[model samples]
Structure formats: structure tokens, C-alpha cells
Target: MWQIFSRFLALGLISFGGPAAHIGYFRKAFVDDLQWLDSKQYASFVALSQFMPGPGSSQVGFAIGYHKGGVLGGLAAFLGFTLPSFLLLFLFAVTSAQWLEISAVQGIIHGLKLLAVVVVADATLSMFTQFCQRKTAKMLMATTAVAIILMPSMLMQIAVLVMAAIIGGILLTRGENITPENPPITLNYSWLALFILCLASSLYFIGQDDTIGQIFAQFFQVGSLVFGGGHVVLPLLEASVGDYITPDRFLTGYALAQAIPGPMFTLATFLGADLWLESPILGAIVATIAIFLPGFLLMLVGLKSWHTISQRPHIAGVLAGVNAAVVGLLFAALYQPVFTSAVIMPLDMALVIIGFSLLKVFKPGIVWLVMGFAATGALLTLI
Candidate 1:
């Protein structure tokens, strides 16, 4: 437990670049350094995380913790891995926006965005290689990407994923579908009930205006409904919460989240604190907790039966299709706000290319990349 705490805490502080990069960080830490889990086990955890509807990388981390020390270990891992982002978001919430105006801070954010491009590009390639080995799968990946780009929205994302699943079921069921080993076979009725209750309660309470209840309900709904990656939640949250928080602050939080480690879902912490300035800490805690609770609940409930479900050929095909759609989702996100928003200049694109080369060839850990890029950006801004 202590080892998990220390290692994940380290990850939380320096693991920027969002879910994809965070997964790479986790693989390096757990699979390579600690040897806590083998590659296959970690891959299985990632597969389950991606298949579920929660925060992608965070769920993977939670599953790893659950495997390590049962529920308590899972909690420890969540707290440890998430603590840094919690602190950073809380600070961003309380601090003046002028702080972001500082040259160094802007530099840090610029560098981080460049880092995000590299990390996400790597993840897209890696997932394609692993999941889209077949020609049909590859074609589906391209088709999904084109569809999302042509008609991008929250509804479109969900629709594309569903269509991808149907296509997967129809097209991918030809081969043997072996169940992944070490399946979580136990069912907790109370857990599922609680998940349903929380979801229902949040929906029930979404209409309360100018109240914490409304905030909680909105964030909770975003958590419950958004699929694929953390970035996918942007449009949903933007549509739902835009009425309360100004677009600038919201975009700022989003960009800042890209720079920080841990789950991008922690953007809830900043939003909560900013919205309820009278009691910022309470706001931060409630908002953060509300947004993530649904995912954790669903994961805890679903992990118990996912592998058994995966054993069916049709279901496996669906998962395969869903996986392809996920890559498409990430690919679409990388283009819209991520690439479009960040890489505005040739220098920015050049920085990203250099970062990618470093990542592929030198293979430095994320901490160094964050620092090096931050410094480079800061120096350039000063110059």
C-alpha cells in the first residue's frame, strides 16, 4: 500500500498529457519499475478501463489498485494518484486569473499542450496497432474518424460509438473470443443499486438553480454520460455548465488541466471552487467528488462481471468495435480543441514534432519532458 501510494503520488505530480500519457506512465511504473503487475495484467486492466464509461486512465489506475489491495488499496491509489491534481485545481480555482498571465505560467501551459499532442499521437498509433490489426478494423477506424470530424458533437460521439459497436458485432465476431484471465466474477447487488441510486438522484436534482446541488448534478451527469476519453467530456460539460461558468475561465481550466497530472476530471475541482467562492474548499471537494463518483461506482460494479461478458464472441466483437471507435474519438479530440487550439503557429508544431522525436528515440520519463519543455517555452516567452 505504501509503495502504491508513493509511486502513484510521484506519477500524479508529473504525469501530464492526459489519459493516454498517464497510461504510458502507469505502464512504465507498475509494469517496468515496480513489477507489481505483468504486461498482460496491465493490458487487461486498460482494456476494461477503456471499455467502461468512466474516466479512462483513472479507472485503469483504480482497477490496478483494486487488484493490489482490494477496495482499500484502490482508495489509496485514487487518493495518491489524484492528490496532486486536486491541489493544483484547487489553487487554480482560488488564484487570480492574472497568474495565468505570467510569462512562465503561459510557457508551462504551451509546453504541456505540445506534450499532449505527442502523447495522444503515440496512443492513437499504439491502439491502432494493438486493436485494428484487421483490414476491416482499420477501415472502421478511418470511417469513424471521418464521421466524427464531419459532424462533431456530443450526440454524434455517442452515436458514432454505438454504430461502431453494431458494426463490430456484425463484422468482428468471426474469430475465437477467449475470456481474459483473472476475471472479477463476484457481483455486488448493493454496489449496482447504489450506482443506480446516485445516477437517478443526480438527474432528479439537476434543476436546482444557483445551488451546489445543481453543480453536483451537472458534473455527475457529465461523468455518467460521457464515453471514450477525458477529452470527450468537453462538449458535454461545455453545453451543460457554460451557463454558470464563463467560457474563458472554463477554457482556462481546460488548458490548465492539460498541464497538470492526474485525471482531467479534476477540472471539476477548479470549477467547483471557482463557482462557489464563498466556500471554495467545500465547493471543490463536492464538485470533484460528484463528477468522479459515478465512474468509480460503475467501474466497481462492472469489473465484477466484465471478463465473463467478454468471453462471448459477439460481445468481444462489440468491444473490438468500441475500441476502434475509442481510437477515433481520441483522434477527433486531438484535432479539434487539442491540436487546433494549441498548435496555432509553426513554432508550436515544430515543438510538437521535436517532442515526439524525443519521446520515440530518447524515451525520457514524463517529468523531464515536462520540465524541459516548460523551460524552453518560458525562455522563448522571455526572449
Candidate 2:
């Protein structure tokens, strides 16, 4: 369990390209490499996480850990995956104001933004191939894509998910059975106790306006309410921190969050650093803890019920629909943040096209692409 946690933690430190990409990384490591769970189980968990909310990739990580070693396993996975981003955000929240002023940092970020587009595009294609195998699933994918592109509103996205659930339920009236060839793993009481302890501590510490207290309260709320992944957290975080931090600073931190590795929730790092610089270290700590609290709680609740939930045909259908919609959401994200924000010139457009080609055609590792682009961007900035 500790070994698994250590591996996931290392992956979290270096993993970039958002939730979709994180899924790819997990598939490669856990499914393809580790053989921890079969493809079907993985698909089910991914679908379940997508349906329930609170950062899909993070939930996936927890599920992987849980499957491997029960509740303690889940905690290890969450900690391993989250720690890097937490540490990075802490440093950034402390130093971003100074570091971001550098032209090189700005240039590197600009280039990395284009890479984000390529990474997400690749992930969308991969997910569609994996999950949208059935004709009904394919239709859901197309419909959701059109709706998201046409509407592009938050409420509309939720409505699309709800409607998809209804449609999926109608289609999946006949049940599909998932037989576990191996015996089911038993839950560990110790892990459950620890999880409960964390929850209790968070609740106890979350008091009115104190730095740590506010962190606990705010993150707990976000974790509890956020349905989508990191992107969904953006507007919410902006609203929460905007009162204390400038819009420009917020935007800059957001941009930096995009460039770094790990979960997009690492945006908490920016919030923490901004608060820390603007106020105190206590503020930074509070902000960091607050942002991740919801996700942890959601994971705990979901794991308790996943066995029963995974069995229902209607639930499966909705997950199928949601997974398809996730593809569309990834597409929309590629268009907005990655393409719109970074690709300003003809050369920039060419670079993006090339990056997409490399990913789609060659399928080189993401790290290589990132490194190549970072160097290209640095050179471009000099020119």
C-alpha cells in the first residue's frame, strides 16, 4: 500500500495535461503496467467518478488505491497524487508574485498552453475510443459535444448531464452484469477510522475567518459541491478569493496552475500563495487545505457505496452517458483555454498544429512534447 502510494505521488508531481491526461497516465500505469485492475473495472470507476463529481481524476486515483488496498490504500493514493500539487502551490502562493514577472516564465507558460490543447485532444480521442464503443454511447457523445459547443454555459452543462442520465436510463433498462472473477476485497476498519478522523479534524478546525479555519471551511464546501473537475472549480475559486486578491493576480495564478503538473485543483496553490503574500502564511495554509477538503470527503462517501452503485443498469447507462459527455467537455476545454488563450499568431497556430500531429500521429510521450515545446517557446520568446 505504501509502495502504491509512493508511485502515485511521484506520478502526481510530474503528471500534467488536466484530468483527461491524468486518466491516460493512470491507464498506462495502473491498467497497462501494474495490472492492478482490469479494463472493465477501470472503466466502471472512471464512469462512476465522472457521475459523482469532485475532480474526476482525483476520484479515479482514490478508486485505484481503494481497489488495491481498501480505505488506507485510497488515502495513500490521494495523498501521493495530491502532495506534489500541494507543495508546488504552497511555493507558488509564496513566490508567484515575484517569479511570474519574468519574461521567460511568461513565454514558457504561453508555449505550455498550446501543449495543453494537444494533450486534451489526444485524451478525448483516446477516451472516445475506449468508452463510446456502443452505438447509443456514440450518439450521446455527438449530442453532448454539440450541446456544449452551442451552449457553453455552466447550467446548460448540468442540464445536458441530467438529460443524458434520463436518456441513458431508458436505453439501459436491461441490465449488464459485471462478474468479478476474483473474490471481492474486504474493507479495512483502520483506514475507515483514519478517514473519519481527517473529516472530524477538518470540521473541528473550520471556524469563522481564521486562516486555517477558513481553509477547512472553504475547501470542504468546494469539495462537497463541485461536480465537474478542476475547470469547474475555476469560477468558484475566483469568487471565493476575488475579495482578497486582485483579478490580475488571480488570472496569473490560474495561468501558472495550467502550466504545472498534478491535478488542476493545484490552483489552490495559487490561491494559497496569493493569500499568503497579500496577508500571511496562515492564509496560505488555510486556502490550500480548504480547496482539497471537498474532494477527500466525496471520495470517502463514494467508496462506501461504489459496490452497490456499480451494479445498477440505469446507473451504468448514466455513467456511459456521462463518460461520453466528458469527451465533449474535454473538447470544449481544448477550444477555450488551450487554443484561445495561447494560439495568437500564424506561427503559434502552426506550432499547435504540429503539436497535435505529433500527438495524434507519432504518439510520443507527453514529457518529451512538453520539453520540446518549452525549449521552442524559450527560443521564440528570445526572438
Candidate 3:
């Protein structure tokens, strides 16, 4: 448990670039270095996260921990990975926003964004090599990437995954055994039941006169319904808390969430602090937990059953399609928010190339990569 916590805690401190980048970081750390799971299993976690609502990368991390050490491990991973962002956002809520104007701070953000580009680009190529081996799979991957790049919306993302699954079911299955050879893990339905119960309770309390209840209800509803991870949650969060939060403050919190390392969903921590006037810290805690709860519960429900269900021939085919589409999804993400956001100047592009080469050829530790890029970014400001 301590091992799980410590490793994820390390990631929490430096896993920037948002959900897509987090996926890349997790792949390199767990799949490539630690060997906690293979590429296929990691891809499966990523695919499963796509189908569910929550922070996509965090869900993948949770699944990895759960894979390694069960429910306790999953909880540890969640806390470890989310702690930095949670605390940072909470602090942002309490402090003045003027520090954002500092040149050094801006430079660090720029460099980390570039590092995200390098890491995500590496992950995309590696996953593409692993998943899109055949012509059909490759075609699926290409078209999915093109479609997402052209029309990038939550609805579009979901539609593409569904289409990929249907196509995979039709064409991907070959001379492969789909039978469950190993003993299957037990499927725990209690988590699903708890999820439903919480959903009901939140809805019920939302109508009451209690501030805390209202906070939980609103955030919980958002968590339960939101798809496409943290980025997609932004608009919904704006709607959920618009009554109490002003547009400018909301955007400010969002900007900070983007610049910082960790899950973007920690925007909840910032907004939650404002919701309760008497004790902002308590509000932050409640809001953070509420917003993240439903996703974790649903994840627990799915993880218990995924191993057995994925063994079925049809399900396996669907998974194959989803896996292929995930590569394209990451590819699309790499270009837009990850690459476009970071690579503004020609020097940035040059730095990205160098970073990618380092990742591919030298394979240095991510901590070193982060430090190097951050320092370089800060230095670039002086030039």
C-alpha cells in the first residue's frame, strides 16, 4: 500500500499536460519501466476509462493500482495522484492570483506544456505500433484520428468509440481463443448499488436548504453524468456552480488548473472552497470528494467485471476496436491541446524534437525530463 501511494504520489507532483498526457506518463512509468502491466492491459484501462465518466487518466491510474493491489491500492493511487492538484488548487483559492503574472511561473508552465507534448507524442507512436498492426486496425486508427481532429467534441468522441466497437465486432476477431482460461475475479455489484444510492441521495438533498448537501448534490450529479474526462467537465461545472461563482473567477481557477501538474478536475477544489463561506477548507474537501466519487464507484463496478466480460469473443472484438480508437484519440489530443498549446515559437518546436529524441533514444527518467524542460523554459524567458 505504501509503495503504491509513494509511486503515485511521485506522479501526482509532475504528471502535467492534462488527461491525455497523464495517460502517456502512466504508460511510460508503469508499462515501460515498472512492468506493472503490459501495453495491452494498460490500453484496456485507457479504453475502459473512455467509456466511463470521470478523470480519464486518473481512472486509468486507479485501475492500474487496483490491478496491482486491489481496492485499497486503488484508493491509495487516487489519493496519491490527486493530492498535489487538490492542495494546490485549494491554496490558489486562498491566495492572491497575482503570482500568475510572474515571468518565472509562466516560463515553468510553458516548459511543462512542451514536456507534455514530448511525452504524449511518444505514447501515441508507441501505442499505435502496439495496437494498429493490421490493415483494418490501422485504417480504424487513422480514420478515428482524422475524425477527432476535424470534429473534436465529447459527443464526437463517444460516437467514434461506438462506431469503432461495432466495426471491430464485425472484422477484428480472428483465429483466437476467447475462452476464459484463468479463474475469473469475482464481480462485486455492491459498488454499483452504492453508486446508484449516492446518486439518489444527492438528488434528494439538492432540493433541501443545506449548503453542504447542495454542494455534494450538484458536484455528484456532474461527476455521475460527465463523460470525456476533465476537459469536458469544465462546461458542466460552470453550469453547476454558476449561481455562486462569477465567470471571471471561474475562468481564473480553470487557468490555474491547466498550468498546474495533476488532474484538471481539481478545479472542483477551487470552486468548492468558495461555495461554503464559514469553512472553505471543508467545502473544498467535500466538493473534491463528491465530484470524484461517482466515477470511482462506477470504475470499481466495472473493474470487478471487466476481466471476465472481456474474455467473451464479441466483447474482445469490441475492446479491440475501442483500443484502436484510443490510439487515435490520443493522437488527436496530442496535436490540439498538447502540441498547439505548447509549441508557439520555433524554439519550442525544436525543444520538443530534442525532448522526443531523449525519450526515445536515451530513455531518461521523467523526473529528470521534467526538471530539464522546466529549467530550459525558464531560461528561454531570459532570451
Candidate 4:
């Protein structure tokens, strides 16, 4: 359990490229390296996490923990996987003003937006290969992509996901048997009680005027309420910080978050720093905790009943639909944040094409691509 926790903690600190990249990291570390679970089991866990609310990576971590040490193990896994980014973000939040204002930082941020395009594209393709095997799933993917391109709204995307689940549940219910391959596992209620106690303590601390309290509350709320994964948190976070921070600064931190190699929620660090300019450290801590709270809570709730839930025929169909919808959401994000912000000139367009091609054709390591792009962007900025 300690070993698993340590591994996830290290990955959490360094794993970047959003949820998709995080998934890759989890697969490499836990699936390929550890041989902890088979490919099918890993895929099933991925599917289950996507179907449930909160960050997909966090849930994956929770699943790993559960596999290792039961419910307590799950909590340790969640903490290990999430703490690094949270700490880094908290640090960044404390020093945001100076860190964000650097010209080199601006250039790198611009480059990172382009990287997002490649990451999202690669993720979409990978998911398609893994999940979009059936005709119904293919149709759903195509239809959702079109809807997102034609009418772009987060709400609409969510509605489509819900509708797809309903349709899929109706259609895919025939001749389906729901059974768990693995025997049902027992949960430690004492661990659950401890989790509740921590949550209560977190809530109480949130009301205090100290920097720690403010951050605790804010991040806890973000983590608890956010339903979808990292991408879905954007609008909610945008709303949360809008009253407190400026658009330009927010965009800057957002761009930096893209450039970094970890969870997107690390943007909380940037936001936290911006919010408490005089105390950037406090900001980073707040941001880190706020973004992760939801994933932790959801994982606990989901793990408690994952065996029963996984065995439902309708649940599989709904997950299939949700995965398709996730692809659509990624497509929309590519257009809005990646294309709209970064792909302006012909040179930028060329880079995007090349980046997409590199990902699709060579299937290069994401970390390498990000580094290569960051270097190329730096050179371009100088030129």
C-alpha cells in the first residue's frame, strides 16, 4: 500500500497532459509496470471512472488503492496521486504575480495552448480506438462531434451525454447479463468514518479568515461539486474565480497549467496566487486542495458500491454513451481554448498540423511532444 501510494504521488506531481495523459501514466505505472490489473480491468476502471462524477484520474487512483489495500488503500491512493500538483499549485499561487508577468512565461503559455490541441486530439483518438468499436458507439461519437461543432455550449454537451445514456440504455438492454468477474469486496466502515470526519473538519476550517481556511473551503467546494472530469470543471471554476480575478491573469495561469505535466486542476495554484497576491503560497495551497476535494469524495462514494454498479447492464451502455460524449467535449475544448487562443497565423496553423500529425502517426510520448513544442514555441517567440 505504501509503495502504491508513493508511486501515484510521484505521478501526480509530474503527470501532465490533462486526464488523458494521466490515464496513460496510470496504465504505464499500474497496468504495465506493476501488473496490478489486466488491460480489460484497467479499461473497465477507466470506463467506470468516466461514468462516475469527479476527475477520472483521481478515481483511477482510488481504484488502484482499493485493489491494493481496500478502502483505506483507496484514500491513500487518492492522496498520493493528487498531492504533488496541489502542492505545486499552492506554491505557484503564492508567487503568481511575479511568475505570471515574465515575458518568457507568456511565450511558454502560448506554446502550451498549442500543446493542448495535440494532447486532446491524441486522447480522442486513443479513446476511439479503445471504446468506439460498436456501430452504436460510432454513430453516437459522430453525432456528438457534430452537435458540439454546430452548437457549442457546455450545457448542451452535458444534455447530449444524458440523452445518449437514455437511448443506449433502451437499445443495449437486450440479452445483457450483469455480473462481476471478481468477487465482491468488503469496505471498512471505520475508514469511511474517518473520511467523513476529515470532510467535516475541512468544512469547519473553510469558514475561517486565514488563508488556509479560505483555500480549504474554495477547493473543497470545487472538488465536491464538479461532476465531470478536469475539462468539465472549467466553467464552474471560471465562475468561481471570476468575481475575484481578472480575465487576463486567469488566462495566463490557465495557459501555464496546460504547459505543465500534471492535472489541469493545478491551475488552482495559479488562481490561488493571483487571488492572494501578497501571499502566493497560501493561494497555491487553496487552489490545490479545492480542485482535488471532489475527486476524493466521489471515489469514496463510488468505490463503496463499484462492484454492484459495474455489474449493471444499463450502466455499461450509459458509460459507453458518456465516453462518446467525453470525446465531443474534448473536440469543443480544442476549438475554444486551443484553436481560438493559439492558432491564429499560418505558422501557428502549420505547427498545429504538425503536432496533430506527430501524435496520430508516430504516437510519440506526450512528455516528449510537450517538451519539443515548448522549445519550438520559445524559438518562434524569439523569431
* TM-score per model over all chains: 0.82, 0.72, 0.67, 0.76
C-alpha lDDT of all candidate models, in order: 0.78, 0.70, 0.80, 0.68
**Per-residue accuracy of model 4 over 1-383 as CA lDDT, tens digit each:** 78878988789767866787788889998899989888877886776677666677777877877877887888788778767766665555555557656766666766777776666566667777766777777777778767866876545655677777776676645455767364565564654575567567667876565466666666666565444476655544654555577655565566666665666766777777776666777666666666666566555665656657767777777777666656655566556544676777898788888988987788777678768887887777677
Tell me how many residue pairs clash in candidate 1.
0
Model 3 lDDT-worst window of ten: 226-235
C-alpha lDDT of candidate 3 relative to the true structure: 0.80
**Residue-wise lDDT of candidate 1 within 104-183, one digit each (tens)?**
88877777667767776776777778888887788888887888778875577668778889999999886764753645
State the lDDT at 189 in candidate 1: 75
Give the per-residue lDDT digits (tens) of candidate 3, residues 18-108. Answer: 6777998899999999999999888878877876778788899999999999989999999999999999989988763567578986787
Cα displacement (angstroms), candidate 4, residue 172, comes to 4.5
Angstrom error of the Cα, residue 250, model 1: value is 4.1
Candidate 2 weakest ten by summed lDDT: 179-188
The ten-residue window of minimal lDDT in model 4 covers: 219-228
Error of 3 at 3 (Å): 9.8
Each prediction's total of clashing residue pairs, residues at least 3 apart in sequence or on different chains, is 0, 7, 0, 16
Q: Which stretches of candidate 2 lie over 4 Å from their true place?
A: 1-7, 14-51, 64-73, 131-153, 172-260, 275-291, 302-305
Model 2 CA lDDT for position 113: 69
Q: What is the Cα-based lDDT of residue 20 in candidate 4?
A: 72
Which candidate gets the maximum TM-score versus the true structure? 1
